[model samples]
Target: MVVTVGLARLCRSVGRTASSLSVPHQAAAAGLPARTRFISTTPASNLQFKLDERTAHSSLDLFKKNTGIIYRMLGLDPSHVQNNPERFRDWAVVLGDERISGGRHYWEVTVKKSQEFRLGVADAQMSRHDCVGTCNTSWVFGYAQRKWFAMTNNKMVPVTLVGRPERVGLLLDYDAGLLSLVDIEKRQIAHAVKAQFKAPLCPAFGLWDGELLTHSGLEEPEGLK
Candidate 1:
């Protein structure tokens, strides 16, 4: 099913604050940093997919062992994370159950209120201890410190947008070796990367604060079609 959704405008500025690597309470106690918090209303047409069972089970087990990692829905919710007094592990990530090895797939992420987050794709065998953009198996567009960046294999390239976009569109053309980040509000491409992707790549997400609502099964934007 294909659905069209409206992208909302950013409501308020959360100020330029550095996000903490630890969970909220620990960050407060350690004087790490503050983050903006907001509630997200899921779109009626929002696409839903099963969580990667293996990864989810392992993450839950790790949480029981006090690993300081937590996955909620499509992204991390640091506010609900607990147990570790140290910084959150770079592996605090999640992958969608579906894998893409062919064809072009598109999805939209509502992130205007998220203080810090990463959206992208990763190999099915990606290391659980590594951040999404820190390994060759993954490619990500991240927002942190009020800046946007595209990253892979530990290399980050700054992405400058005209303004903050309330919704970001990701288009992955697997056969073409292309991944593009679109600024939905501006109806323009924010960044694009080309790579010989390995088959069965999974949609990946890493969130430090706020929430992300994903709308999938979307028709390609008119300009791109």
Candidate 2:
């Protein structure tokens, strides 16, 4: 999808804020090496494949913003904001204005060691009050309270992997019924799940702190070109 909104128009859309971008939380396993005990069937991590920022569009209209889930962006650098300290309270914003169906798509998200952020895709009808990964409409890989999780149907499934990933890549295959998360730094697959999607999916994010979630506009590497 082509997103033509200029910087000025985008600011009006999200009601630009003065809050400084927050740093990622320091995780307990912050410095450990990335380790995945389960083997992956996909190609070795493709560090070069990132969502093209030029193709990114703010799906702000698709989100429910009345609940204090703030959205801000300077050019393509978009971040979710929530300044006050509140437990179990999370805010999310989706990327790309259009819904995706029946194809392979990937994006790399860089996050701090904080144990409270989520990266994944959610059905367009996902509940605004439901934190990503805590409901059936979403499939998210997240970290909370020093543990890694892949939540679906409001159930927390612990993902056993050594250390933490600074840059994680998400790959969605609609037809294949697969959602995969890769540890980009380690060139390894962190986790994968199979699901029969019922509706169009959007790239969604969840954050509890002021942590910045940069949409690294990476494309297939030169060799693929």
TM-score of each: 0.63, 0.56
List, residue by residue over 20-114, the lDDT tens digit for candidate 2.
11111122102222222221224443222222222222322112222112233332223443322211122344433335555666676666544
Most accurate candidate by TM-score: 1
Best by lDDT: 1
- Tell me the spans in candidate 1 whose CA falls farther than 4 Å from its real position: 1-50, 53-90
User: What is the Å distance of residue 103 in model 1 from its true position?
Assistant: 0.9
Q: How much lDDT does each candidate structure score?
A: 0.56, 0.47
Off by over 4 Å in 2: 1-96, 220-225
Clashes by residue pair, model 2: 25-114
